[model samples]
Target: MAYTPELSNDQSRTLRRIAWALNMPMTKAMNAVFEYAGNIIDKKRVCAACKDNSKCNTCAFNQKRWSGSPHDHQKNKELCLLSLIKK
Candidate 1:
């Protein structure tokens, strides 16, 4: 049997409108939203220093990615320095 998600009336309407605006099928639109949220959740799981491959070597925190963010991790520190600079 196929699985059906139980979204509220408002949530269903909003998703339908977003799919129409993007000119994509509802399934694709939902996948895009899910993927975006998953990435953000993964990013928030670590600080910028811990997330960087190069910096991870000399990072003062010396924390592993799987260990999660440090206790003193500030909101601003969550933003990656490389991402802020336009390439």
Candidate 2:
């Protein structure tokens, strides 16, 4: 897989710290941290804490529902099947 270049050393270090706090392996932590950062940056969403909000649309830690969407359900089911197959 091609590596995604990090925007800056500070960004990279912050992501690593987040990963460590979550107790994830380095690779998985890196991937998850970058993915969440990408969503926030690309979506132009405000930070949840800065907004003094419990949850925001782009917060990675949010656990809101993906309900009432057939496509979402289908995609989730497909991922589940793929994981099972891999196992």
What tens-digit string does per-residue lDDT give for candidate 1 at 1-87? 278878899998988876776567777767555533433454434555254566564433344532554333334332322232258
Best by lDDT: 1
- C-alpha RMSD for every candidate: 12.9, 11.3
Alpha-carbon runs more than 4 Å astray in model 2: 1-3, 34-87
- In model 2, pairs of residues that clash are none
Lowest lDDT 10-mer window, candidate 2? 76-85
TM-score of each: 0.42, 0.33
